[model samples]
Target: MKRFFAKKVITALLFTLILFTFSFLNWKVAYPDLKVSALSYWTDNEQNKWEQLSTLIANVSNTMSDKVFEKYTYIETYGYIQELLGKNEINNFEVIKATDGTLHYTYFTSGANDVSKLVERMKRLNQAASEVGSKVIYVMTPDKYITGVTKFERGMPYNYANETADNFLEELADEEIDTIDFRDLMKEDDQYKPESFYKTDHHWKIETAFWAFTKFVDVLEEKYGFEFPNEELYANLDNYNQITYKDSYIGSMGRKEGKLYSKVEDFTFIYPKFDTNFYFYAQSGSQEIKTEGRFEKSVTFTSLLSGDGDVYDATNDKYFTYMDGNPAFAEVNNFNEPNGAKVLFIKDSLMVPVASFFSLGCSKVYMIDPRYYYGNIEKVISDYKFDYIFVSYTPQNLTEEFFPFYESNLPGRWWMHDCPFINWNGVL
Candidate 1:
């Protein structure tokens, strides 16, 4: 009995020591930030003493939490423990793992969001574009959670993003705004299935985006009388070199859930085997960067795949390999097909891969992510005068964050400049 009592005391002492070590490490990491925040309380005249104290406490608390030693390892270990317990919910249920071991972002919501304001803003944007003889088409990308296809265990939470998308699309159609609902294709089209999406990520797979690119071309040709030379050649999968990097990618949600909870997925890299050249340009503020060369050398960030470290690390995000991740504004000038359509895409991150694929058969493809862009969007539409404009967004992004045209600053036309590939004069 004495021996057992001694063992219990030793175990308790060791656990206390381990807790102290972790706490000390976290405090050390947060010390500098805490010092700065505390000092700012004296210097800052913007708020009252109580408010400043509140802010300082909040900052210190956040730093201590975020700067915890081996934070990700702790998270991964926690996820593994959760898996062992057959837990469906993780991270206070901010992320849920389906029975199939897929990580998904979800929240508790009672019903669909009010999308009427979003529709009105889109209508205004459409009217602005139409005034300049440019047609606007709202392209609804599929959400990761397909209504009937993805199933959660009993008593699991659901965020109503799909239902919200349904109402949003119906409202857009009622306004006489043109739309292509990819959800309908996901349900009816035999070619596309739940497999089209990434199990661990919110976005669809790169291969799925390539397939959607072909559909976009068909829409342009059949509905709008647009034509691209060598359309079939570009659309053919055989024309591209397909390389699959097995068990490489851990997507946005997967990063949160960790490797033990979410299975790593295969990332397939597809690019044209044909001789292709593109002048890629991206701009933010007064700064501009351009890459001009073959498709592999220019658009795709090959360094992402070749970089050192575990591919599952949140830093080595493979989904961002296309278009070098999202920027405020970017455009691709396709030299191979000079006579192709000049198109503009106002989109979210999901369309990055899709736009990259669409650029294959286009003379120029201008893309804007409103979430990051601060420019005058209406002015840009009037200035560029693209043949057709596509406003693409995933269902989860139907909020005002993606529709910021009215609030966008009229920062004057600063992008008009001399470039070797760009037609600043707007001549096709």
Candidate 2:
């Protein structure tokens, strides 16, 4: 009875300490946010007050959790404990470590998604492209999990994202829409391995993305009769200065898993050795920013490579060092190669580097991440009349979040051309 009482007392003390620490760390951050959220809801003129309140509450909850003091410390401690326990899964297997020591995000999925709607949406997009004398090609970026490779211990969850991707591409093929599955190409390559991908993130490594870009260039040349000047030199890795930042990157999945469980990655920042000039523009809901210089100065976010702070810092996402994370709309104009080709990419974050490298061979490169873009894509297509349009998404991103404008049947909006942000003149 005495031992039981002692144990209860200890547990109570520990719980009290945690509560006190959290309150001390988060109250300042949460109180103001909550107050602003409440005030916004009060002033909001929207019809759905209840829904707004719910969303505000959810946002507040996330803020509280996120602002918790020493959150990474707690995560690291938990991850360390998980490691001590010899466990392969964490948080009830929301994240599973592969047998090869790579981390994967997964959820329970029974079967492949019915992608007929998505395929139809692509068809509509293709039709729009065809009307402007532009070609649409769906580039399927590979998932981290290679079918026979990327093994998990028995009884781990499988999300069937790969199966959905297979179904999605097959449907597109049946519709006679052109497609490129990087999975097939990667599998055929003798050099592609589990390590070709980030051990902790869904994204492929920079080198892999570069390789994909070269392959894409080949496709454009052989099939579309698209020519890139100085192809041999531009395609060669030796032509670029490859700077590898040792153990500086902690990917998205790694951020969730913590440094203790998912170790940091070595990030390679590659830039061209030859002279080049570019005008880069990015616009999102919150900000509009532009840069002009050579490839490194313009496209690459050099601050990320400064290596001044914690490598495990969540904000120090090295993958985003290229193209500075995905914006709603971004463009790159290569002044030297202005007469080459104009290309547009409807893509997810994976295509950031792909498009960046592609800019070298193109006069202009325009990119849109549909998740954040609220504009009329049909309008953009009609206006630009791009030489080629590539829709690139990782296999796992075969979801509606990546297809925001598909449901709307409205014609190209006249307002889109009038928007100050849209570049009517090819001059930056």
Candidate 3:
């Protein structure tokens, strides 16, 4: 019996060794040609060669797993079961079905560490703005769930995002920071309907953004004495040509849930009816492109119905149709408002539409996403001599570790390339 057991053990060990050898060989052949950059520490020295081998093995394993799940029927079945059981969550997003027959993507809340980091960043931002003699208005846009439009019960384990945002705003208030909590206005507005936000996406509908922009304009005028051209242009939705694509969109959230679980949503594109000329200079990576024409021609359109392509591509992301899909840095010189106040807007994806609308009030809008912008932001502010500085971000963006002011933490990254730490004391 001992002899038989020893033989079995030897066989098992040989089998394991053979399997590992095959895996190593497969990794060598299928390894991705990753760019050797400062961001990756593996490309440092010959001694660190093991790092590449390990990473290649991990990548191959993940690729194989993905292929398995893609073809396996049981994996999809399990995902469906998880969705029905309310256990489906991917990348902090879970599809919640509202009583109104609409699906919404809800995200997890910010932890204590995230909130604390956000508060610290905001304090630093306040000091930076003071030093630069720029008035800062921090705007926090609410998620769909924050307005109480969903049918789900409050205080669910997944519903703490609103609470996190509230806590952050409360802390900001305690610090006497100037802020615009749009969630309050959204909740108070009687005109807001279920359609105010996208049924299948995490972003608010264009109508909702327009409504919020109007209220924001009021705040700007009342608080900062800034004047916007032709409030009537925006006040009346009819003034803009509205084109609706029925049953057209499957948002970032819905795509994750798949068509089997999440229903399709509609998309509406609104453009100004009045004659306007906008010259946009957009820079991403090392490429810079300049375009000048009417709003429809000048702005990059990602919508399938935008007369760009023949068939509607399911992968066509319409969210990026605004401001050409959020370039790392962009400058819009509005000929319509030449000599108007120059404004510096730092924001996340939430401000895509808002930045376009801002052109009506400002001569030039310098927009940058700190996540992608690598240049020294302090230099941009000083060069433009911006009359107003607006910082807009959603609660989820606020909780991100790489929030605008904390870009220094991410070394050799997109936000830190060519970026310099501002001497707040020297500016003051």
Candidate 4:
């Protein structure tokens, strides 16, 4: 019995030595510059020696751990077990499988509370826009899960998103705010097939956006009496250049779960067939760059096809191919509709594909993503003299910590320029 115990201790010591040696060699090869230096602990004469040594040890330990886990065999086994048990949530994303073997990501809600602050902010914005004769229209876009919930198994526990949106919309209506709820439109539209949203992505497909845009146009025409063109363009499938890539795309959610649990999905990119010339202006920091070109001739050209090289490449986000991802601020001047009205379209990533389509009805469309755009939103509305102020965002965005109107400054702080609205002193 004593011999057996002695043998086990020796074996454990041997294993520990081997692991330490392997980790050291790997770290030395990977990070040759991470050497012990006499001055490293005394850089600028204020650095603490103990703190530097502790940081160095922690970094090396983390690197070794990462290397070991990169090829760990148990990770795949653990993920498989989790999936089998229907416990496939990763971080804040819940991976729910549809009956058709499609994967959809449902983000956990951040709780619904008093959006009174947000409502009050919107009311102030409406009053200011009303003074300038600009109609403020709030369009609440639906999440993929909300519209595609029928595909999911009954009694899933993530209804907080729907509840939150409903509460906010109800509050907005009670406050006499003009809101166009696309959730109702999506529910009524027969075209909202299971394929309306991406199987692996949280965002709805381009076709879905087109359908929602049509409904929004209808609301504009009915309430504000605005005549919008290209009404039939979206209705006809022949008007779009559809490029399909089968079993080639994996969205943000898929990337999070890895290929083990999340299956690859097909991507169908739909580009407008009509000829539209677009002059784009993007503001970044203190510099503004302007580019004048056609839709097919610019960065949007990539939207016509998947990423360059093999279709199976998983590096590029295929959805970002449309409208060049999310820019801080962009102004699209559609020469095709020079006589159309000028509008300010504020939205999130859900509105990326649909943003340029607005130019078909409006001459100049200022697309501002409040999450990234730190400029004065109210000033932009006043300066542009926008005939319409359209706020389009998904329901999940309502629960976002960075939801636009919730900010005390209406559009949040301006990191790039000084926000004049902050110092308006009750001046409309």
Candidate 5:
């Protein structure tokens, strides 16, 4: 029996070596994608222990950016070892100690390159909108640091380096571009903290997102003469001292960390009244998990919002399906009447929740985020002849705007043909 067991062990070792050789060759052949497509799948039951072999391969993979690799090294090499053994879900976000024991996100380096680029690019886009007839509006979203407190073992409280943000907003208005500052609508009550916007994520809390909804409604009414009924949104400022979740939160950017226990502030289930009942036609080609409840609920009942909540819901399920460039269609059964004007929205993921309320004002709203839409934008717009063209973006990727509306198929506009407008030689 001992001899037979030894032989079996030797056979198993040989087979493992052969499999590794095959996987390595397969990955090497697919290097341009960094074997990113191949390595994503992890056999659910195989995560018994960390694999040193996988780590060595990850070190050798040529295409990974250092930033991306550092953030996901565990998944790229070790696999999800503890989870397979049925250990509790991991703590997704950990504040690493700096030299002085100050905790911070692994990638929380300070810089303003992103916001500066975004506003400048948006100015050009806003100018393009003016050339064509529709006006542009800038909506700045509040980061998690601004709206609420994130429970942390941290160093110092950090605010967005948007010192130049207000100047940029003023610059847009100085040029006569229409704009909305949403920070005005956020709960100013001192108690709101990081956990309110997203229980397990970096997003603004649900009710706060809804407050942004109120701002959009009021502003859209002022701009287009559309009517939106008054909404009394719920804003919970008291009882924040109570302990909840206890580190089980896994935010959007933080989810990769895999930690399961985190403490956070939570919102109540109070629903606001809406005048019209709406229908949600999901963006096709999606395998998204449905969330439940009024908003992104606790980990104990994550399905609470199912993410299909009313657009007014922070995790509003309605328009986001299309924000990523899918066919997320929304409609009001009897929208009072004359609901005929068409419009196009060029935006990013931050605009997803924003669109939830904006879509309410227009009879026909066609929103397309260029990152997800590979088609020509002008062609899409000319085909539809939208009455208004609105461009919105968040501070994170604001500077990276491509001429999403530029298309060879469309007619040359007077502005495009005439450089004279940009540089007037003493006269128009």
Candidate 6:
């Protein structure tokens, strides 16, 4: 027994020696992605411990590397937040002095991207609509930053392209383009400051969305010569600031910041009582025509006719957000429209709630986005004979934001190719 124990101890010591030799001689091979991947393990960058250890293993060493290393660190040596770490990221804003002589500055500053391309797309859509005897109206989506509710990183730039909201509106007026200026609608209500956007995310309050709902009703009455029952769908525009999640969400912007997620209270969408139900479609060949039963009460998987399940393997769970697996070519039918008007909208996800408000306006509504289209839109509008057409986006992302997402998915995927809207839009 003593001899066995002695042999085990001897073997363990020998293995440790071999590992230490490897760690000293060839560390880079063992950990090829050391900087980006191993950052979490290092507590201090200013210290020489990592350098001393790694230099023995690696023949190559960085001179004056501590400057670059310090930039990678978020917090400083004294445990204070370091402003120097993030040079290219964060927002710029004015700071005021408190009575206590303390500096007061907003953590998040408003910002946006491009607007020129969005305007060009709108011009094209309106021209196409006029050719088909259907007029085009646009919806101006407001971003979280524009709304003043998104928490911008501390040191990022807050500039948009030269074309701002005022300039874009002026250009639109100069060109005689018709649009639903939701920004004006938001500013009028004043119930929500621009700060009502999600602090850590890119969505707005449902309460503010109610104002959008009621505005749509008015737009319809004035333009299409029809009255909608607005009182039924929206009772009040109640604001809420209740916290949903208080943590670091690690949003897509690549910033390391803590976020406090909140939601609205007494939220409701006023939809007039339905005398008759309508069928909804998904991308899948199988259809769910209104009469079908057996959906979970809280969950809605509305249409099954135009699009496929996000995950072919998963049931009742899908990856698409905002519009519920919407396709460029899907149709909306109401059977309730007295004039039997057909409407078509070319837009992004901001049109989700806006489209829902349009439930009573048209017997059939078709959706299209040039970014998602596989073919032509003009030919599709001619064939459908739409009474109204709309193309819109928030000023920020209205430009070429989706170009990369669109390009990567082409050849294309089943959702974009066989999907009817993409091919039909270009042909129309």
Model 5 — TM-score against the truth? 0.54
Q: Arrange candidates, best lDDT first.
A: 2, 1, 4, 3, 6, 5
Which pairs clash in the backbone of model 4?
Answer: none
- Candidate number achieving the greatest TM-score relative to the actual structure: 2
Candidate maximizing lDDT: 2
Model 1 stretches astray by more than 4 angstroms = 1-69, 284-288, 310-313, 407-428
Candidate 6 residue-wise lDDT, 235-293, digit = tens: 23332122222221222221222111111122122233334333333221212222211
Error of 4 at 133 (Å): 1.9
Tens-digit lDDT track of model 3 for 180-280: 88877776885346667787677788777767778888888898787787777754567778777776676766655555556567777877788778777
The per-residue C-alpha lDDT of model 4 at residue 281 equals: 68
Predicted candidate 1 versus true structure: per-residue lDDT over 183-246, tens digit per residue:
7765665544567878888888888888888887787788878786788788888999888888
Q: In model 4, what lDDT does residue 347 have?
A: 80
Summed over model 5, clashes come to: 37
Output the TM-score of candidate 2.
Answer: 0.87
Cα-based lDDT at residue 313, candidate 5: 25
Query: How many clashes does the backbone of model 6 have?
Result: 38
> What TM-score do all the candidates reach, one by one?
0.80, 0.87, 0.73, 0.72, 0.54, 0.53
Misplaced by over 4 Å in model 4 are 1-87, 92-94, 98-111, 147-156, 230-235, 284-291, 299-306, 309-315, 404-416, 419-428
On residues 1-428, what C-alpha lDDT tens digit does candidate 2 reach at each position? 99999999999999999888868768875676667656655654244566446656776787787666666788899988888887898778888998989988888778877887789888888888899999999999888888877799999988888899999998999999999888888877743578788898888899998998898888778877888987988899889999999888888778775888888879898889988899888876435768899999998888888987666664467777778878878889899886888989999988899889989988999898887564667778888899899998987788887875445456654333222347533354
Global lDDT for candidate 4? 0.65
Clashing pairs in 3: none
Instruction: Give the C-alpha lDDT of model 6.
Output: 0.43
Q: Candidate 5 on 146-185: residue-level lDDT in tens?
A: 4233333444333343444566676677666677665545
Tell me the number of clashing residue pairs for each predicted model.
0, 0, 0, 0, 37, 38
